[model samples]
Target: MPSPRPSLTLTLLQARETAMRFFRPQLNLHDLTEQQWRVIRILRQQGELENHQLARLACILKPSMSGVLARLQRDGLVGRRRMLEDQRRVLVSLTEQGEQCFASMSLEMEKNYQRIQQQMGEEKLATLLELLRELRGVKP
Candidate 1:
């Protein structure tokens, strides 16, 4: 017998792709992968963070985060340094150029967000966001 309901995991992934379609062009233009942008966005908002903290907030695995940070550092978008007080801890921060890139890209990103809001209606979008947050809090 066929299940009547769609797979929730697959549906969520599809929904993410649909949303990403709006912003992927800006990312491509900036030569940033999704992980790189997520790291930059978090660092821009949170200031310097320990490497593990950054990976957690960015939802990127530790192994993959090393490559993402390397690419960003190579492009002069990010910097990494060992904490002076805690020699074993590494901190990551965005460079000046990274901030400038974020500022420029944010305009386009905001416009795309506004377009999505307009298409969906502000109230519904807000409700959807709240619902998504609640859903994320669910556990098996």
Candidate 2:
């Protein structure tokens, strides 16, 4: 008889899908895609960053970041300005609308986090975080 393969990959995939279910509804309320929301959240936490920096912070590729910036600019949620020292370099920042949207969405995101934490409890949550960090080769 063949032994069962490890289920870690399946568990990770399922967890990701479940988390998206929680995120999708909140994102839809703000008319934001998951990638867009990720960008906004990264900006909120990291402050202003250039396009390439933002892409790195958001874990997205440069081409996708370009599209996200275009959409954000078109929606008046983000603004860009040439760097004073280097005209070729562009700095990106959130507009008033973007800040306001992030503030609202942040609350929603917090609530989701809290709900999960409560469901899992502190011990399990800590273990989960430790496991995830180890998986990513990050020391806890």
Candidate 3:
């Protein structure tokens, strides 16, 4: 009989945790959780996005996104506004402080990324990223 295969989902999660090991210190130093860092990163790149859109991109659930946004808002790192055209729709964006925070952390994050690329050569890192993107595009 053939040996059992390892669980793909668990393996992917473990890989993610391994990758996060390099960046978690920076996040913790800024008093940010992984979820908050994701939200901030997305907002920085995309400018302003609707709450649902932000949640989806950040891989956060609707229910949990509320708390995450609440904390960010409370900390004055992000701001939310209701759409005038669609009252139900909420928009989220990074505030000045959020931008500053991102700027402050950019150097450390870049260094960590460089360290990773150095450890796992640029070609290998590129291939891994491409494979992950392709895997994400796979249809169930």
lDDT of each: 0.94, 0.87, 0.97
Measured by TM-score, how close is model 3 to the native structure? Answer: 0.97
- Candidate 2 local lDDT, residue 53: 90
By TM-score, the better pick of 1 and 3 is 3
Cα lDDT tens digits for candidate 2, 1-140: 99998798899999988878877889999999888888888877787899889988787899988999999889988889999999988988888999999988888888888888898898998999898978988456
In model 1, residue pairs whose N, Cα or C atoms come closer than 3 Å (at least 3 residues apart or on different chains), thus clashing, are none
Per-residue CA lDDT of candidate 1, range 78-127, in tens? 99999889899999999999999899999999999998999999999999
Clash count of each predicted structure: 0, 0, 0
Tens-place lDDT per residue, model 3, 1-140, is 99989999999999899899999999999999999999999999999999999999999999999999999999999999999999999999999999999999999999999999999999999999999999989998
Tell me which residue pairs clash in candidate 2: none
> How does candidate 2 fare on TM-score?
0.85
- Which has the higher lDDT value, candidate number 2 or candidate number 3? 3
Cα RMSD (Å) between model 1 and the true structure? 1.2
User: Which should have the higher TM-score, number 2 or number 3?
Assistant: 3
* Candidate 2 overall lDDT versus native: 0.87
lDDT at 133, model 2: 79
